[model samples]
Target: MPASIIEVPVVDPPLAAIGTSDGDEAARIQARLIELGFWVSGADGDYGLTTRQAVMAFQKYMGFNDPDGKVDEPTAAALTNMDLRPVSRANSGTLVEIDKGKQLLYFVIDGKTEWVLNASTGNGQSYTEPDQNTPGEIISGVSLTPSGLHNVNRERPEGWWEGDLGEIYRPKYFVGGVAVHGSNSIPNYPASHGCVRVSVPAMDWIWESGIMPMDSPVWVHDGA
Candidate 1:
């Protein structure tokens, strides 16, 4: 099937928060967002936090400043003309490519981004956590998601994986102490404690769909 050609009419600038007044238009926008791999269920033309979060995720994938999940004219246009294969360097094989600068995660198979999810990585700040083994002694590390190559070495199914920093939902561990897991909050910014965070629904879908199976290569790069 070919990509759908969506023609969204140009509308007046948002007088308040930007959202859909028309149910049909909202459905069309939701369809495009889901097709591009942002996790959003029930595109029954209802626009709410779920749709807004999906839009924020879409904006992150497109390397746009997503302060609000408003469906602007340009954003709608880009979604309509989305590129299936967004990442250029990883031209072959299956890999999890994370554009840290873009704050987006791409599940690539055969050079195409099967799914694009909005993610939050380390915020480059530092925090102190007491040692697991030694009491009264703390260990400190900068809250930075390391950029490089990694492989999915472990996965936790249907449970929360506790860590020194925090707990992750259904985590798929790639690097030491760093995995892509589900979270209740997936803000459109870098706010993790050195791990990558996706929405709970997105993570569940990834696991259910086997998007990041064991030994899958995960490439973290700044350039999208």
Candidate 2:
């Protein structure tokens, strides 16, 4: 048997339907874009300019004849092949909680502590520039490790805090900009710009243990 070559037929953009109106449809589109390596602001149901732009970019990458910002039949067919489900614990191992306040990374299995390590988080108490009066604060809300259940959304070979730090090779976990990654130097307390800092050994352990599977659940408590 030979692999079938998918021939994308020419089709006009469905103007009758400008964009997705359903929340689930938007989520699917957003997930498809993300899987195709396009960063999306949010998966809200509104198919605004950003989503359209992302769609065009995806089409261009696929070598389409016209990378128009419209979801044509070809685009729809390509998207249908993607797995856009949100990350879930059911597909991964136990939850691993990193307590920024306590400076500890706890690996919990079946509601029991399996391993622990000294970690560091965004020093919500430093200034990036000495002349500036405002202290360097981690972006609030989404950037801040919310005190609730979330998953290890994605990982990147390169760190997202590109401009902040000088050029350096490092892997970052995209659980927000905060990641469980290695640091050349670890300060006594919270020091990262916003990410969760782990020792080289600790990072290797987590990666090898498969604790933080894609979309693995994470909980950040305020120690209340």
Candidate 3:
């Protein structure tokens, strides 16, 4: 018998230009493409060749005369109209807040709150005698979390911590090493080398939530 034909259904792409591939939108597109028998290696919100091929295959299946690897109107429409299953909304919209004084990480989602186990802050003790009484005393808590608008600039799977100090594990977002990431252990006080410490679950939630847009606002504080 000849090789069986795996009947693949058609998928209409979204009507809207499917906004920039970031956060939830990217994840959704990736999932849908994979479901339609398209090879999407990973869902990182990047519209690469794999995603394009998937779109093209979907278009062909949908009976479109021009099944080019482009998410044109018809292709988008097919994907949008398909009877695709919905993904779970776990880690939908969560914001990360790092408190230096309290040494805590907060995940704000849907107006609710989820706190990480423990976190440490920068070293507040130990200082050299300022040039033999040149200055009275160096102030503590001088290095506050640089307050400003920032975002998840970069994300690394492994091999990030080679010449790093302190206790921080998977460092995902690197805003000058002041990232919101996972750690081996978190203390209930300032102890980090200079990075925000969060739990693994919390880190994963941040990644999945897709709320932290590029150049998002990040507010760091001493204490309320």
Candidate 4:
């Protein structure tokens, strides 16, 4: 070794991205995430993979853009003081309220949020599906989840229920070819063909619990 040569070690920067993953701050954040309905099954103050995923889900539903799952100052503040809520003009009854703007699904029974789940709705894009009006042909329509009052007309307890555009799990059809179902991929934005996409576990719960039964009212709207 040369006496004149000085070897300096490189230092890494702190993980100061967003949403604290560990520490008291992270624990508080996790508690808030659970309160705000972001599903933190393992919220124990330790910022691990589960906490990160829960934070990501919160960011997605809250309409914040932190793809890295770090809660920035603004995001943390917003999480603490979030005011975005699903609004239903309906007087009172058992119904499922879906907010496409916020990508959230609220299982409301008699005017209470029984279960809150991260959801995705229509992406307002172009899509093609088999035409029921014509034989051996397909039809094109805008990929959209219509915002209106509907009834739970049908349901499919089977998994991976096939659709012309894609597949859904344990779908409960509300309108014509549109349902609030389960999907493995529920992003932070609207990405469904024309249905509401919830978590697979959530879908199973909906079915097993029979929350939204047949003929139950379903209200789909957004104030954003």
Candidate 5:
């Protein structure tokens, strides 16, 4: 008699991306992200803007290219087995690290990057814009995200603020006239004038959670 052959089963990879509304899949992804300390607002079974932004942040943290917030096979696989997390440059302290080169922000707790976010820093371009502080006065300077050690000096806890350049949401001022604020447009690369821009929801979370309190050390570096 001939030997019997055993059948092997094939498994399919997860498929979810921007605009995908599969509740189960979306919830799974969101839960995984939250478990990894990613800020997804909540796992509400909706792959919406907040979820997409969180996915983008995860991709950037993993050093993936073209982080388009697509949870395809590769992205899902990587997410499933992800072990690497951003390391804090500071030896030991609770601080916020702004990586200019990576355009990523890290919430470091005791030298460990507990959470990460997609951030848009300065674009390094010269510009002249109306200064909100002074009427009919224009300010001229380079749009540069200054790299140095600083601390959170002040913060606007509620509502949008009319900054020198434009409206910033819940800005946490660190350096002189520079802050880590919220914006609707936080591109992959640097785009802000001088402030570090994150999502509005993220800024809200920062304030509501009291993660970055007053005088919290903020280290801005080029990651070089």
Candidate 6:
């Protein structure tokens, strides 16, 4: 070893990318997400699908370019600072606002956005599928998420219901056949058959919270 040579210690960057393993770091992240109104099934140490969805929701709400659900140094810092909370577009009353542009859902209460979740809406693409009524014939329609004010006219309280396109869990129909419902796959981008798709756990929480009840106002629009 040279006398003038000096040693430097390398340090690992701050990250909590949880997988199957359970740890306190995962639990802390989950708790913070829940506190910030990102719906996780529980604050357990396991970073499962629910926690991942919640992290994704938080990232999307914060307008991150890459919301990959990975808790990196930037995400950890943002989580520590609690000033960034989502706001509602509406002026008054409680309602559900679906921002198609952002692919997010805002649960507004008293004009304040209390909860934010990642959502997938219509992809604005034409599709052809077998008609349920007549399997031999094909049906065609554009996958469009209707914009404007609507109300919860119908809903399926529990279990999965077979829809024209696919199975929707606990659907809360607002306009025609379109509803904000639980889905198995809620990608960061808009991809749905004319429905608002949130994580299955999120949909369960929404039902339990009663945020959007029967006749509850639902406003769907592109981002500002």
Quantify all predictions' global Cα lDDT against the true fold.
0.74, 0.52, 0.49, 0.69, 0.80, 0.80
Model 3 Cα lDDT, one tens digit per residue, 1-224 = 11111234444445444533445566667676666434455677787544554454455445466555566655666676676321111133445555554444444444333322234555555433332223464322333345444566776645335423333445655467566666644443455545676545444545565645555445455544
Worst lDDT run of 10 residues, candidate 1, spans 1-10
Cα distance off (Å), candidate 2, residue 38: 38
Alpha-carbon deviation at 152 in model 5, angstroms: 0.5
Residue range with the least summed lDDT across 10 consecutive positions in model 4: 6-15
Alpha-carbon lDDT of model 5 = 0.80
lDDT string for model 5 (161-221, tens) is 7888999999999988899999999877789899999999899889999999999989999
Q: Write the per-residue lDDT of candidate 4 for residues 1-224, one digit (tens) a residue.
A: 32222233221221233455577667777666665556555457788654665666566655565444578866666666664332334435678888776677767666545445677789999977775445688878887999999999988888885576666798888999999988888777788888998777667777877777899888888745
**Candidate 6, lDDT over the whole model:** 0.80
Give model 2's TM-score versus the native structure.
Answer: 0.45
Under the 3 Å rule for N, CA and C atoms, how many clashes does model 5 have?
Answer: 0
lDDT of 3 at 74: 59
Any idea what lDDT model 3 has?
0.49
Q: Which lDDT value does model 2 have at 80?
A: 60
Clashing pairs in 4: 18-70, 18-71, 18-72, 19-70, 19-71, 21-47
Clashes by residue pair, model 1:
none
User: What is the per-residue lDDT of model 1 for residues 1-224, given as tens digits with 9 covering 90 to 100?
Assistant: 32222233333332222355547678777776665557676578888756777788777666685546788876776676665534435666789988788787877777655666778899999888886556687879898888999999988897675566666799988999799999987787899887899878778778888878999999998763
Model 3 — which ten-residue stretch has the worst lDDT? 84-93
* Candidate 4 residue runs with Cα over 4 Å from true position: 1-30, 40-57, 60-70, 80-91, 129-136
Task: Candidate 6: list runs displaced more than 4 Å.
Answer: 1-21
Clashing pairs in 2: none
4 versus 5: better TM-score goes to: 5
lDDT leaderboard ranking: 6, 5, 1, 4, 2, 3
Better by lDDT, candidate 6 or 4: 6
Error of 6 at 119 (Å): 0.7
